[model samples]
Target: MEMEKAREALMVEEEASELVSRLDVRPHRAGRDASFYEGFALRGIRVDHIQPGLLTCSFKVPPRLTDSSGNLSPGAIANLVDEVGSAALHADGHHMKVSVDMSISYMSTAKVEDELEIISRVLGHKGGYSGTYVLLSNKTTGQIVAEGRHSLFGKLKSKI
Candidate 1:
C-alpha cells in the first residue's frame, strides 16, 4: 500500500509539472507583440466587414479555446466580446480606449469547429467615454451565442 501511494504521488507531481509548463505564456518581445492569451483567443478570426461604428467578423471555434466538453469556453467568449466590441469604436478612427466595464450574457454554446458570427456596434460616445454592443451568433443556425455590452473610457487620439 505504501509503495502504491508513493507511486500515485509521483504521478500527480509529474502531471502538475506538465500542466505548469504548458501554461507558461511567453512574454511580449516587442511593442507590437501581443500577449499569449490575446493571440490564443484571437487566432483564426476573420473580419468580414468594418465601417464607422460597426464591425462584423466570422470565427471558427478553435479546439484550443474549447472547454473540457469541447464547447467554446466562457472566458474566450468574453475576450471575443471585448476585442470585437472595442474595434467598433476604433473603426471610426484608430482611437484605442481602455475597457472600464463589461457585461456579457451567454445565451448558448458553440462547439469546436462551429462557425460563429460576431457583430459590434457603437451605442454612442461621450467625451472620453463610449459604449459598444456586441452580438455573437451561430453562423449556420442563426442562434445567438452571446450578447455583450462593453463600456470604455480614455483620451481619444488618432493613431494608426
Candidate 2:
C-alpha cells in the first residue's frame, strides 16, 4: 500500500511538471533594457524560461534573504514565488498583474548560499480569474523547499 501511494504521488508530481512545460512562455527581459530588473533588484533572479502557463526563476540564497534559523525566510520565498508567477503572466508582452491572493506552504528549509529554483505555472485562466502554482526547490539537492498558489487580476499598462 505504501508503495502504491508513493507511485501515485510520483505520478501526480510528474503531471504537474508536464503541465508547467506546456505553458512555455519565456520571461521578458528585453523590454526595459534590463534596467527595470536592476531597479527592482530582481536582476539577481535569473529567469530560466517562460511558457504559456509556466515560468521558472533561479536565485542564490543570499544572507539578506535568510532568517535567524539559518534558512531562507518564508516571506522572502513567498515574495519570489509571487514575483515569478506574476512575471509569467506579463512575460508574453508588457502588462501588469496584481496578485489577488497567495498561499504558500514551506516544506523544508533552504540555507544561505543554496541555489534555489522556482517554477511557477498557471493552473487555470477564465474570465478575470487566473490561478498559478509555484514550486520552490533547492537546486543542489533537488528537494522541494516550498510551494504556493496565487490568483491574479491583470491590466494593460502604457509602454514606458
Question: lDDT winner among the candidates?
Answer: 1
Q: What is the lDDT of residue 90 in candidate 2?
A: 64
Q: Count clashing pairs, candidate 1.
A: 0
Q: Superposing all C-alpha atoms, what RMSD in Å does each candidate have to the true structure?
A: 6.0, 16.2
The 10 consecutive residues of candidate 2 with the worst lDDT sum are 34-43
Instruction: State TM-scores per candidate.
Output: 0.82, 0.68
**Top model by TM-score, which number?**
1
Per-model C-alpha lDDT, please? Answer: 0.91, 0.78
As a TM-score, model 1 comes out at 0.82
Q: Candidate 2: what lDDT?
A: 0.78
Candidate 2 lDDT over 80-136, as tens digits, reads 878888877766443567789999989999998899898888787766667788899
lDDT of 2 at 28: 62
- Please write out the lDDT profile of model 1 over residues 88-138, one tens digit for every residue: 988967477999999999999999999999999999999999999999999
